[model samples]
Structures are given as structure tokens and as C-alpha cells.
Target: MMKRVLVFVFTSWAVLHVRAQSFSEVTNLLDSPTVGVFAVGTSIIDVNSDGLLDLYRFQGTFLQQPDGSFLESSGDIGFKNEDGSTAEGSTVFGAIFGDYDNDGYVDAFFEDLTAGSRLFRNRGDGSFYQANQETGIEIFSALQGSVWADFDNDGLLDLFVGGDGDPSGLFLNNGDDTFENASANVGYSPFRNVYGVAAADFDNDGDIDIYLSSCSQFAAASRNMLFRNDGQAGFTDIAPSLGLDDDRGGWAVVWADVNNDGWLDLFVANQPVSGAGIESRPGFNRMYINDGAGGFTDMAP
Candidate 1:
């Protein structure tokens, strides 16, 4: 009886030791640490219908996180740390993912900050192929404001890009792996150095109009321009009459229905107002609220 009891005690001790080892292994995996490096993904959207907004971030590599917090993979490009050593080449900003090709997989449009931007068409089997070279979309050379909209009321989506001093590009989807450059035809050319752009059907004409923010510097002379869509390749500039010229070099503009009157109001953010003139406010900001009826009132000092 004594011998049997001793054998049982030894067996139990070994079992407990093995369990502890397994627990430690699991804990170590949970503590697996990695340093995040890039910040290109400035926009978020729901693509996979998983009820979570996936992260379309650029950290020298394209990273897709399902829950917006946890990373699933870095795609073909790898992740790199602070050290000079790299895992991926470069990435894009102003990125939006959607089924642009109707291939049932989300495609990517990212600004190549180091060079030109890129359009990456996703393969159905969890990989991506580059489309920038073939698409002729030059993202890096432009000034960096981009918004994707289905302009022209086409069944397919198109790209409306805004840049600084450089004319914006409109890569109209041809629906056949080709895009047409309609910037000049669309009245987006010869524009002053534009920074940010937003689109809305402001006049409620069943089509979207465009608003752009322009500034010489952060505080120098600047103007906010409005382009009203006249339905087929025609636009009119209505910024001056809209009282939007009262700007200390506008930086960002958005349309909001401030009075709940069903009409969209314009909101403009300008340079700091606490200074003497436009030069006084170095990095300060102001806002201009539109009162409708084609005029804007200053709401910020």
C-alpha cells in the first residue's frame, strides 16, 4: 500500500509540471510584441461586412486589421521596426478600399508618399497586384487631396483628386481595365494650389458639386472656391459671391446643414485670427459658417 501511494504522488507531480509549461507558452504568445511604424491609412471604411471597420494603414507596408485594432497580416510586404532595416518599400495615403474591378475582392488606392501614389487591385486568393503603372495614376506628383466618387452619374466610381498648384486628375473608370484622364475636360485644370476638396450635391441638383480649399501658406492670402456642376462637363465658380473670400487662406472645407433646413451650409477653417493680419496667425485656425442663400458668415475670430 505504501509503494502504490508513492507511485500516485509522483504521477500527479509530473502532470502538474506539464500543465504549467503549457500555460507559460500560451502566456508568452499573448505577450507577443511588435512596434507599429507607418501612418498612411488616414481613411477608414466597411468593406468586408464583418461589422467592424478594417484598418487600411500604411506602415511602410500595407496592413489590414479586421477589428481595427488587431492586425491579421501585412500582405506580401512585411513589417519593419524603428531600425533602418526595412520590411516593405513604401505606402500610400488617402487610401480607400472597394471592389473597383467588380472582382468580388476589395481593391486598394493609396498615395505613394515617397513617390507617386498607387492603385493596387486585389487578387481573389488573398494577394494584391499593382495597377499604378498600367492605370497611369500619378499620386505622388500631385499635392495629396483625394476623394473617390461616382461622378458623371456613371454606374462605376471615379477619382476626384486635389493637389497644391497642380491640376487635379480625374481617372474616369472605363470598366475595362483602363481609365480616361478627364481633368482638363472636367474643369479641374489650371487650378491654384489646392489643398483639400469635398463633394456634395449642394444645389440639390441630383449631382454633386465640389468645394476646394486653397492657401499660399498657412496664413498668407488664400481663397475658397466653389464649382457648381452644370450637368455635362460644365462648372461655374461661385466662391466670391458666396462670401467665402473672407478667408485667411482656408485650409479645410466641409458642407453641413447647420440650421436643419435641408440645405447644406459651408464650414471653412482658416488660419489663426488672434494675430494682426494673415501673417500674425502662424498655426492658428478659424471657421466660417455659411448661412445659406449663397453667402457665408464668419463664425470664428
Candidate 2:
């Protein structure tokens, strides 16, 4: 199934094209804008079931107001950093929102390189507290990728974290606010510098498969990996046979039905950021077309 590369320049069903609109920059902040406190990621979600979306940055949070405006409520919600006046804070590499405890509220997870990862449990009253001791999630590395989904169809969302310099971890929700380390149990505890991760049922097998956009530092390349769920909470590295083991510096991996086919296809962004050592392979983006028969064909031109 050597199909031609399909680039998505527009949506699948689009007729009328419109001109791009311009946006004006907003330079206002609550505390005269504490300058820069290393704002990297933001999660806009309905944190309190108010039907209005709220915002959460690493430095603080911006709660939506009734008048369609944003109010700085980071300090009030207990999510703000300690130093913000003179700009002395670190950056949050990645964050995700999920109600892992089956609660009515959504919780947050933040990954910080210098300060380790943290799990913030939502108090259902617009406030949150760190719950690393309660959830059994304590990872520390150059953390980056984070994804939350009910991969096992267990009715609760599971958590996966990718980081450099150590093996990434996967946490399976125990359905009662606590979690257990499922990385080794699921056969996916790869000791690679994992930067990206995503899940999809590429084979239409009723179970979700995982894709790890992994790359190593210090000249050694880890390549990418795809773990097919065994439907029994187990996984197997089925990357080589599917042409998914591209040794380029895998950064981000995403799968979609590119040709509107029933089977899902994959695309990965590559950019090696190795240390002062020679990279193992050249960095280049890759596209893999699912052949619908437990295999993939590289469709990149």
C-alpha cells in the first residue's frame, strides 16, 4: 500500500475560504504583570463546573469573569508561584487536566524540570493542592510530554508522562483517587528520552495503542516506538514491523484518519536536540500510512 503523501492544507469538508483575521496584542496583567515568571503552558478548562472556562498558567491562573473578562485568581486558587514580582520562577514543561479520581471536578498535573513533577488535586472549590504523596506519581527529570485518557476503557483516565534522562512512566487509575505504576506491568517502561506520546486504535482492534516519540541525548538515538495494547492490559513494541521506528529525533507524534479511511495513520515531528555529541541519525519528519493489515508504509516523499 504505497500511497502518495497526503498533506492536510484544509479540512476534509470545506468550500468557502475566508481571509485571515488579525488580532491585537493584550499587555495587561493583574499585578502590573509581574514581568515574566516563565509562563510556558496554559490549560483552559471548566475547573469548577461553572459552565465558564477558566485558565491556568504555570505562574498563575486567569479565571473567567461574568462580563467575559479574565480575573487574576492564581493567588486565591493557590496555584501561583512564590516569586513573581521580580521574575524569578521556572517554566512548566507540560500540564494536563483530568478527573483521575472520578470526582466531579477536574484536576491538574504539572511537570517542571527544576522542581520535579506535581499532581494538583482539585478541591472542588476553585482551589487545588499538591497530591503527589496521595497518588503515587513522583517523577523528576527533564519532563515534557503528558497525556491523560481512558486507554484501557476502565472508565477512569490514566496518566502518562515522558521525560529525558530517565524512563518514562504510566500510571493506571485505581478508580479511588489513587494510582499505581503501570509502566512495567504494561511492558512500556522504555528507558529512552521520551518527548511525545499519543494513543489511538490504529488497527480498529477495540483497544488503544500507544506511540512514543522518543529521542535520546548525548549522541545516542532511541528512535520512536509504538506499543500495541494486548487487550489484557499488556503492550508489545510493534514498531519495527510497521515502519514506525524512525531513528530521527522524534519530538511529537500524532495519528489521524488522513485519507478518511477507517484505519488511523500517523505523523511525527522530528528535531534532534542531543547534547554536545554526534547524533546517531539525521532528523526528519516522517509519515506512516496504515495498511489496515498490522503494518505501515512510509508515505513521505
Candidate 3:
């Protein structure tokens, strides 16, 4: 009986290993050369209004087919420059899809490190056109993450872009396919090296609040900020009083009701300082639990 049990276990393990080996590699189907590099952003959306979802990578865009394969379509989809050239060496970071003009078609937004940001408006006829200049939504800075939300309870969607050295821009929708820069007027002054941004109503109020993650290596004090909406088309910084003022290197931020107690909480991702090698100590990730009132406690110990 012992011999039979051992044989049975060995046979089952061998069959599982063989099955795993049967799955072959199909990555060679992509036309681009595999350079073993980090990709900044990837978004899956139907670019041509087709039933199939398409892939948008920082390197280029790919369209999905019925055969479960993707074909590069960045040039065909007008993601290149007006001179019919791609951003060869530029670093593209974030990509998001939203109906900015309420045209029933999802438009695309791509954030670049140095080449500025681009907005691609989707035409219903299965094509996209760069409308950043026309829409008055251009930002000439090192942009990182971007988010779209109706902060002022407006019917149209507004845009918030996080920057590296420049102050983050908040573009309020004018309902006419154009935007007005309202960053200074909305209490986003004294900007640092902003990285990621998240927008949600933490106080259960009708207005949306803003949370920005900042990072730098200048030995300058940097802390993540939270701006509360005043419901009068303005915002107030309430992060320092809420115990969120820390000098850690912040990267990304996310807000959600983690405990499901009808209040929203914040999660921040941190990293070591720039140029800090493996010998440097890493920053700890934090989770700030929100009380039913307006206070927050760092539960990351």
C-alpha cells in the first residue's frame, strides 16, 4: 500500500509539470523588439468603437483581433505628431479615457515626462484627432498622473494634472469643449514635486476633495496634501491638521472606504529618495484610516 501511494503522488506531480510545460510562448507575435524595459502606462479601450478591446502601451498602441492577437496601430490611430512621427525618446507616463466633451465617445489623455501632455478626441467614425491646443488643455511641464472628476458638481468633467516642478494644474470644464485654468484660484498653491493624485469625497460631502503625493531629493520637506472643497468653487488645504504632514517620498495615492464604514480612507505608496541606491533605507507605505468625523489616523505602524 505504501508503494502504491508513492507511485500515485509521483505520477500526479509529473502530469502537472508536463501540463505546465505545454503552454508555449507567443510573445513573438508583437512586432516591436523586446527591449526589456519598464512600461509607464497601459490602457485597454476600444479605440475604433469596435466590439474588441484594444491595447495602448507607452511604446505604441495595438488593436486586438478576432484571433486573440494584437496589431500595432499607433500611426494609423493618429498618436504621432503632426509631422507624422512618433515620440521616439520621450517618456510617456499615464493614459486615461474619458468623454471630455460629452460627445458619447471616449477620448484619450496621455501624459509625457517632457513633451507635454496630449488629448486625443475620438471621432465617431473610428478615428482620433489631437485636440489639445484647440481644447485649451495643454500643459507644458513634466507631468506624471492625471485624473478627471466633476469637482464643482458641474455637469462637465474637469481635469487635474500632477506635475514634477511646476504647480499642478486644475482645468475647470466650461461646457463648451474648452477649459479654464483654475489651479491658482482653487487653492493649489506652494506646489512641490507632485507625483500622483486622487479625488474623492472623504467627508461624505457633495463635493470632491483632492489628494496629491509629492516627492523630491533636494532634502526639501515634502508631504502629501489633501485639499478640501469649500463648495464655492474653491478649496482649502486641510492636510497638516489631519496628521498627514510627513517628509517621506510619496509616489501614488488612492482613496477608498477600506473598512466599509461609510467613510473614505487614504493609501499612499512611498519610495526611497532619488539617487538612493540599494543601501538606502526604503520608505514605508501608509494607510490613513478616516474617522466618521473629519480626522484621520495613520494605521501603518
Candidate 4:
């Protein structure tokens, strides 16, 4: 029965005719002067609670109009610092939205490189106020990627931030509006040169495990790390037992049930570094099939 439906869909898709759509240049709609600036991170959310999705660039926020257009409104919405100034000459990498306070409104977190990270509490009226000082999650590091998950199973979202040179941190949510630094206590302090972070329950342990993609310029070799949750707040390094000890430079990572076996497999995107160009010798990506017994086998040849 499913095979007939699949054959019908394939035949219909093969015979369907579609026209290529053309997009018009609408650069003049945005009024912000820093539109062409180097934007590294972006997040789309209904910042105003007006049922319209808004765009958040590294420079500022853009509110969507009723006509499906965007207008820059960060300067008017109190996204500036306490001194009423904007961040300049700093690198912003990741932007994430969540209801950290459980106030029924989504807040924003912007990870910066030179300066510390920033968290903006949504005012529920289209405005926002910087709440990093009150939250205590701000850290001065070269931040790269941010991931949110309930690592402790406390019914609150915790934050995991990846960065360079002793910059990775795990901020455990205090269930209030604040967070506590739990990286060192949780056995994640040794990972210094992390770039990307992801969370999953690879062993089906009900608690989420962490995966970090790390690389360093000073080291001759680098490998990714996987930390299994200890059911407490601490973690145990399980990558070596899982046969993930490759010294390749890894960036992004994700997990999915690729083989329909109800076990989540791992995928790591790698890149070359230190005079190794793609044309000279390309770096191969990796995929690891989970053995459902707390181990992984590299399926990439």
C-alpha cells in the first residue's frame, strides 16, 4: 500500500511542470546604515509579540511590517548598552532566543568575541533591556556558537557556549532569571578551543549528552569530544570508548537516526587548516553510526 503511494508521488513529481521564480532586489527597504556590515549571526522571532516574525542581525533588530517587509528598529527598541551606546569593533557570532525567565516572552542572547556576551530581556512590548549583568552569564571570550538544552533535567533551559582558547562555558540555569557558572565543576574546563556544540541522548539515557567540536592553532592535532551526562550536573568523557579519536579539525555537529534503527547517529563537518587547501587535499567529513550500546563506529571511508 505504501509502495503504490510512493510510486504515484514519484510519477506526479516527474511530470509536474514548475516555473523558476525571479527575486527582485529590494535593498532599499531597510533604513539602517549598517546593513552591509559583516553579520555573523542571526535569529528570527516574534520579538514584539505581534504575531509577526522579526529579524535579528548582529548589527540590530529589524521588525517585520504587515506588507511582508522589514524595518530597522533596534535603535528605538533599547538594544543599546547601559550607556546608550552600541557595540563597535567587536565580533558577534551567535544569536539565540529563549524564554529564560519563563515570563511568556522570548529573550535574546548575543555572543560576542572581544567583549562579553549580552542577554536582552524582552519587555513584552516590543522593547528589550540588556540583562547580562543581572544574569551573570556574561563572559569575556572569543565566543563562537551557543546551544540551549535542559542538561540537568531541571525543567529549565541551560546554556552551553563554545569559543576559542579557554572560552567554553556551561551556564546552569538557576530557575530564576540568573545562571551560575558550572563549567569547571562539570568537568568541561579542559576543552579550550571549542567551536561548535550540540546536545543529544545518544545512549538513550534520558539525560542529554554534549558534543564539542574543537580545534587549536598551537596543537599539531585536534579531535572532537563527547561528554556523557552522569545524571548529575557532571559529565564523563566517553569519546575514546566510542572510537571517535580522530585528530581532524571539526566544526559543526548534529545527530539523527540515519538508519531507521531508532538510534541517533552522529555527523561531523570538518575543514582543513594550516596551509592545507581544498584543492590540494580535501578534508573528509565523518559520520558515526551509534551501536546503541554506548559506542559509535565511524562509517565514513
Candidate 1's error at 24, in angstroms?
30
Off by over 4 Å in 3: 1-35, 81-84, 87-89, 218-220, 274-282
Clashes of 3: 0
C-alpha positional error of residue 9 in candidate 2 after TM-score superposition, expressed in Å: 19
For model 4, what is the C-alpha lDDT against the true structure? 0.75
Q: Which ranges of candidate 2 are over 4 A from the true structure?
A: 1-37, 81-91, 217-220, 272-276
lDDT (10s digit) by residue, model 3, range 1-301: 4654475566667767897775678766666655775566788888777788887778687888788788887777777665766642267888888888887777888888887788878887656887889889877788887888887797788888888877678898899999998888976755858888899878877788889888776434467788898875588888889987655788889997676566779999888764643233267888999998889989997
Query: How many steric overlaps are in each model, in order?
Result: 7, 0, 0, 0
**Candidate 1: where are CA atoms >4 Å away?**
1-40, 47-51, 60-69, 76-93, 103-105, 112-114, 218-221, 271-292
What does candidate 2's lDDT look like per residue over 1-301, in tens digits?
2221232334433312433555565545333364656566668798766889876666667777786667877667667655543111245776788888876888888876566788888898868888989888877766777788777788888887876666778888888778888888876676568878888778877777789887765434566888888775578888887778777778878998777655789999988554556554667688888878887887887
94: Cα error in model 1, Å: 2.7
Error of 2 at 197 (Å): 1.3
Residue 87's lDDT within candidate 1 is 27
User: What lDDT, from 0 to 1, does candidate 3 have?
Assistant: 0.78
> Could you estimate the TM-score for every candidate?
0.69, 0.81, 0.81, 0.80
Look at candidate 4 and tell me the lDDT of residue 47: 83
Pairs that clash in candidate 1:
38-59, 92-111, 112-117, 116-140, 117-140, 165-193, 272-284
Instruction: Write down the RMSD of all candidates, one decimal each.
Output: 16.6, 5.4, 10.6, 6.2
Query: In candidate 1, how many Å is residue 9 off?
Result: 71
Using lDDT as the measure, what is the rank order of every candidate, best first? 3, 4, 2, 1
Q: What is the lDDT of residue 148 in candidate 3?
A: 86
